[model samples]
Target chain A: MRRGLILLGALLALAACQQTPAPRQALFVVLPGDDGHIGAITVNDGKREILLDRPYAASESRGGVTAPVQTSEVEVRQVFGAALAARPILPVHFRLYFQTGSDRLTPESDAAYRAVFDDIRRRPVYQVEVVGHTDTTGVAARNQDLSQQRAASMRDRLVRDGIAAGAITTAGRGELDQAVPTARGVDEPRNRRVEVTVR
Target chain B: MHKFVWAGVATLALAGLAGPAMAAGAVIGQVKTVAGQAFVLRDGGRVAARPGDAVQEKDVLETGADGAIGVTFIDNSVFSSGPNSQVSLEEFSFDSSNFKGAMTSEVRRGTLTVVSGDIARSTPGSMKVKTPTAIMGVRGTTFAVQVKP
Candidate 1:
């Protein structure tokens, strides 16, 4: 149903290539913007010109009736994937913070662990990077060992969650790469964390 | 000779961008992971997807109940589609060296998250995702969209 329109658009693009081509119109719309909350989206399909003002503001009212007829529009994507099919996909990077001195995930970040798992499970990610960091609070040497323990704990948890243990690589940055830079012996909650990159 | 000349020009243009050498039809990205009942529809045909499957431009992607999928594009743009969502990649043009290009896709229903890439970073206005009522001109590093069906 929706697929026909997309095919028609592509065929038209090919046909137009032979004729005096119009600025290649996408079957879908491409918006321009200046601000985040207040902006405009223009939909010009040759004949129809739509200037939607503050579309985000209007979506709240019209969201209930949302359904585009064309269901499957794919192709422009394959051109890239097919072009570099041989190149490896880059790993996805995610960061989760922990408690100040403990290896336990922060209450907020613990909730975020599900999202990280979802990302891992969505793809055949062979490499999982779990690097732990700590606030500049303790001795640098001890912080390194503590951070490694934190990293190893995350690795095991990912394994228990179904990812292969062999797929994981762990490291501990200790007091390095603090989210909020501080002088030595400073306690920063944001600095205590594990960074995960899945490939 | 004309075809050869045009091909030569295109090669030069692509070389300037350090673009990937594309086949007659290229696959822009691949499905890195899939869960539940996700499907890929290409050429009017629908099939379930698995890890390491390629996702081409002009392909319609959908996720059923209990389904989800993650995709990574050549330009480093990542998309994650949640259950009951329909998405399409309508247009894309990327220049590798300058990292300047445009990408346009649409989601008909459900949830989708896009992690921006070179195209969006270099030219923020070039990345767009349209839903039923609104078109999103992505400006941030990452964003999520939810369209009501």
Candidate 2:
């Protein structure tokens, strides 16, 4: 047991070596949305600090907002835009495929599911939208049912693994969104999949 | 906070609409998104960066070990830098109406992502994103640039 502890300690130290320092200075333009869902962050237990809900000019390590000595409307107006030309901004997206005609995850997708779970676990406030898709081989209605089944299956697994059910929203694409494009009635292994977007 | 960032931003928009165009060194952008502790070192003063804060030319943007930020320039171009990164806007000129101007930013270290906007679209070769190893000429495309630590 002591030897196992030592190995674990060594592994953690190795992981720690990969993290680089964060960049503090940047200029941004808020995209169109209610309160702009730019991104969310959670600090490591001791070393992380985050600034939430506001357009940040700069923030210190203790979550302190920096006051700009010089600022003017022409400067601000130069950046903020009219809502007329708003462009949609997208966040993180992950897709995992299912076994043929079944809601069960293929081996590769099972591994992907675990990786995504790790990401979800890191955020203090996060929501995931998971959509399931299927190959075009089946009838339209049946494909819809299978796709939803796959979504439900993944949701259930997540809940069983201690993730909050409320954190997830599931939908079925019914073979409508294919990862690898295929013709009608074609059985594309890549088309049978689930897409999870986490933010 | 004596004044909110959005309020400052609103006034800026009104000023432009009223036809008194800003001088060359006007605030060109705001800090759109920040995760973790990022800071701006300007004129020998250091300030913590938050979303909505105005950004100017020649400001040195730095990220702490756990910090990262996303910036939207006046021309609607987007730039994001990953942790332990350092970058600065070298030159910026934009006429919002026609999106006619050029932008140059240098990534001294770490990772950066850029999405070309109106300026690049209108003037195909108006923007250049420089990293330590190579100079990237952006022409209306989304791309990521990284420098090994």
The TM-scores of all predictions, comma-separated, are 0.42, 0.39
lDDT of 1 by residue, B2-102 (tens): 99999989866775567544334466777877878888886555889877677787777898877777787756777877677789988878864356888
- Candidate 1 residue lDDT tens string, A1-199: 6799999999999887888533311222111222243334344333333444432221221322222222121422321222222223455678888887889899999999998788778654455668899999979999998899889989988899988887677888888778799999998888899978776
- Model 2, residue B65: C-alpha shift (Å): 0.8
Off by over 4 Å in 1: A1-199, B1-24
Candidate 2 residue lDDT tens string, A69-153: 2333343333322111121232356888888899999898898888878877765445566888899997989999999999899
Candidate 2 — which residues are off by over 4 angstroms? A1-199, B1-24
Candidate 1 TM-score on chain B:
0.81
Q: Which model scores highest in DockQ? A: 1
Top lDDT model: 1
Q: DockQ scores for all the models shown? A: 0.07, 0.02
Query: Which lDDT values do the candidates have, in the order given?
Result: 0.67, 0.64
